[model samples]
Target: MTPFVAVVFVLLVLCSSTLVAHGGDAEAGAYMLIATSSMKPKASCSGHKVAPSNEASLNSTWAPLHLVSGPCSPAYSRGTDSSSTDDDVTSIAKMLDADQHRVAYIQKRLAGGDTSNGVAGASWDGQTTDVGTYLPASNVGVGAVSHVRPISSLNKMIGTTAAPDGTSAVRQTVIIDSGSDVPWVQCQPCPLLVCHPQRDPLFDPATSTTYSAVPCSSAACARLGPYRRGCSANVQCQFGFTYTDGATATGTYSSDDLTLGPYDVVRGFLFGCAHADRGSTFSFDVSGTLALGGGAQSFVQQTATQYGRVFSYCIPPSPSSLGFITLGVPPQRAALVPTFVSTPLLSSSSMPPTFYRVLLRAIIVAGRPLPVPPTVFSASSVIASTIVISRLPPTAYQALRAAFRSAMTMYRTAPPVSILDTCYDFTGVRSITLPSIALVFDGGATVNLDAAGILLQGCLAFAPTATDRMPGFIGNVQQRTLEVVYDVPGKAIRFRSAAC
Candidate 1:
């Protein structure tokens, strides 16, 4: 296994949803932001992926994060040069060394055999560490896993009233992964034996006058699901997480004051302050991760009542373009936003709610329907996660791949990269044209894959599944530049083409 093959599956805490009934649309006055951050992309035709590096520049003060209104932001400290100090060189070198160790760990575990969580139905449980271990991108058609998907940020944003230090509004850049439920930030003076090097300064709860620990008796503590810690022991709320790629972290859970809206200050904001962490798969960009999930402790689930459980994000395919995630919108207010399609979220009794799964019906390629079963993308019977339909069992994928190969027979082929097996010959070619691909989900949610998503230079952006043993995923490459609106309370997802 290699770093190029690792994907994510997150599980964690929760809180009951409660909100005051608003007479009008609770999401009426939402903020429309053009926020963005620097990200790394592959250099043209090199067939090599440049792992995401901090580069996207926002106003540093323009609309931050996903809140409709908020002074809430994560701090982003300037990056230090590796050659500046021995310590700097040491830290970077340490991370590089850890990357090799991570490879060994994953290979050893996979060799040991199946450790899938004992969950029934179509969904496979636990983490899936396949291919080259924990990779950032997978090959589209030419096996060139060169692109870094959107949804995660290089800088982390936390809720803030004013920069306590009177600096940039950003404290750190954080990743927003919807697949996982745990929300955590790196912390300082950890009560543990080790802490990973964070690009942004760690959060020192002791210095935050408003910080307070979560007690074991609280209901909020009960919904912590898998993330709740120490209630039976020290009575201090805590949590520990280990990703499939051999990354592990542990820390305390607490409440603190944070600025949510433009001027609104919220007390008792729950989050993790991880003081101890050991992992090599991190993107090396920021404080920690902001949870955009369906669990109780997840930022989305906890704030459902206030915003009608609605949130939206728009990401441009190019790292240079603007992309941002916004949270909390009322169903009544969603009408104001135009959408190309909407689909129902599949129902699940599983814990740590499946926040991204949808009911897909079929896929039409260049006007022809591929011979595939709806069961491959439906219900709890399919051993799948988000059930994108793009992902399928090995046998099914083979069939789909064959059909695609036949459909694209007209185009001359090129060399392969990563797991991406299909490509167009560029021999002296300039611009290339691609066929249209569309995914039809329930509720008439039809997403058409445009050139940007289909053609990566001369390669057809269709990569093979790592292994049938792991749960399938809908890579962000396919979802590029799309506006995905999650209406949890409404039990549906809306999608449309957007420029921001």
Candidate 2:
């Protein structure tokens, strides 16, 4: 439907087709040119020469074809843009053109054609020449010029098919290195100088009948021999270092010389000897005790010695094959180790052995019930004149409560009730009741008035959330306070000084 979608679909189809056509068997084919020697000269006028029955005995083989200067022939002559004509030459002088090579005529054989001049005499245009017909003049002893002619008898021969037994009856022959005198065979495989599984003993320098093992350290051993180390009286150890005993004074010795001692003891005593006497000392002090335990303990001790005292504990395994190993200061160090079965001991009362302190403090203040304490009020409002209701003093809160009571009384016995009856009937009603309302006073009412001032001062001081309002309510109160303090003309200041 879209250009991008159509392009993607076409790409998918092309890739799928390509992948199917070039399956796993895909490989590049090796191309080799088969050489031949005996072929007809321009008989069909194609680039390759066709083999004649009697002279087609040459076998096809892998060989480099020779390029030589040969006579050219006029196989096709253009009469017009679309058609061509040909003529054949039989005389030697006539065959040799200005090109300095004999030209041979080629006639395309047709069934039931005239035999005399050979079907519309076509000249052999200088092109591919037959090897047999173009043999060197010096090779022929006859001094007279060789007569050049087309062999027409080849027309009687029929094409042969190869036998099923990996043999072909029809073989092609090509002239190879014709310009050089060196004779070369065609089908023989090329000589390979490198060593292989089929051939061994590439070179033999000796004529003796006796056999002897060659010493690896000898000069002659350099020829196809194993590597060797220089002669030394010390025995080579597992780590490639030389080792000897320290007891012997003259004889060359090694760890094997001291039967009762460990290799390290022998090494220590022998290594302390002079260089020349190192290999001759066979006995060593095997009486000293060897420290075998605590490689890990030694590491820890060294660390503590370099760094300072460190406390550590080994934790028992957990039930889920997990536990912890701890080190350093008491509560500061911990390591998780998963073993088979154990429980991790976590103490809630114990404090971490770090420098930081954790303190818990409680502040108490009295106020009317709300949410958050007034101390949580924004610091920005503290510098402003706005009276945040949530941050009102206790006296201001009482004044606002009194105002609420008076407003509710006025609403119950107000003239608006009579006005409402004039518009709608409710004369049978004996009792008068109004919906309950909540009062919210502004900061100006509390900041200037006695009760309001006390409420605001109480709010400004810290009070518990059990008796105070949220910080958001405090901001709302500040806004209301601003409205009351700076009233615009014709704008009635609505204050929650009464209850509904």
Candidate 3:
């Protein structure tokens, strides 16, 4: 182990008791504000205009163990050299280091400033537009999602079982992020070298009997967005989505089955079957990206009617363990409703359509509120659910750090973490009092945070925003241990602290 992590582990061992029984408040009084919500998900999967060939495959095909193959591979490489290390901490830390770049790329996209789909322009490979050979993109960054998740545990949320069909599921790892739009997989004719390399095998569209291209004139093609379209003579709706980290894929739009639940088969699922790619293989390290973003092309959108357009996820703090992303209303029914406190979803054409925007009203530190301006959390509409950004905005980051430092009682002069500026001395310390961080959202919904949610090792978790002009981002760190649910169609978001 590295010296820093070693020290942290030792400190954790010594202060185990103090941390386990820390006398922090668990504000259970805020349940009613979230419980009154009557919104829930209902099954309505039949309205889709699916091709006749894809119906049987969607309803009957069962690929059990589909997630088993997507291992959180410990693949780390700085430049030309890549290391497949089994060491958990080293792999995850390296992955996070790489994440900074991807985060920057995503921030720019969320900013919605990029107009060049790189079509009458240069593509990610710096190649001129070649509709005959490959669709091109420009200013594309080199990044992939499979490189993010840890391989310690498997996908328990997705089912693994044999079906009546002759074929069984091939399990694979997935990078679960709400910032992405549309689901995609490397398909037949996918090159191992140019494709985003992941532990999982590429999705071979040719093998699936139910697969077929989405017509160029179809509504689904239009929903995929004109920015992603590339036309060829008699093109079967060629579509492409440029990942912020610079990974670009241009391919035919195709339909197939995706089993989110045991019996819940998403038939005629629309996804990009990339025949052309550029930059890095890490992006395809897993089978493909399972997009959870808020755009019309996301997995959630196509399946919204089935689940009333609602989904929730809980990303565990453990680097190795995986969390659950539940689509539609949870089986707990009304019992699950009261367990969450939520904020409203925000939207503006300026923001990325795939993002989930939140209207953050204010942040309470200890007993005092910060001087953060409303501009940091600007919203034209009440935020029911916001895009789950992977990083924070610079303005918000600076403001939060200032407020937190002022409120902290144990402001030990420790070194800073990656993006976190507010840190305290965690060495040889026991029974330190932590400040109460209450996040106030729209509709007067306030979610009080606990120590376990923020403190990482000895440092405060919030970091400086990567970009100065970047907008607000509700990162995974802030949502840690919170069961956040998004009802896209209803334009609502609900959450509450839970064991997830």
TM-score of each: 0.64, 0.11, 0.68
**Candidate 3 runs further than 4 Å off:** 1-25, 28-112, 116-157, 227-235, 280-284, 320-322, 349-351, 371-399, 406-412, 430-432, 464-470
Q: How far out, in Å, is residue 123 in model 2?
A: 99
Better of 1 and 2 by lDDT: 1
- Model 3, residue 49: what's the lDDT? 16
Instruction: State which candidate has the highest lDDT.
Output: 3
- Model 1, residue 164: what's the lDDT? 30
Candidate 1 residue-wise lDDT at 56: 28
As a whole number from 0 to 100, the lDDT of residue 284 in candidate 1 is 43
Error of 1 at 125 (Å): 19
**Over 4 Å off in model 1, which ranges?**
1-170, 190-193, 231-235, 330-338, 350-354, 379-390, 393-396, 406-415, 424-427, 456-458, 463-472
Q: Is candidate 1 or candidate 2 better by TM-score?
A: 1
lDDT per residue (tens digit) for residues 269-372 in model 2 = 11010112122111111101111111111112222332122312111100011111111222111121111111111112232111011111111112222332
Worst 10 residues of 2 by lDDT: 7-16
Candidate 1 residue-pair clash tally: 58
How much is 42 displaced in model 1, in angstroms? Answer: 9.8
lDDT of 1 by residue, 202-317 (tens): 56665555567787777777766655656536677777666655566667777765443222333456777777766554434345555666667776665554445666654334
The candidate maximizing TM-score is 3
Model 2 ranges with Cα > 4 A deviation: 1-395, 413-465, 468-473, 477-500
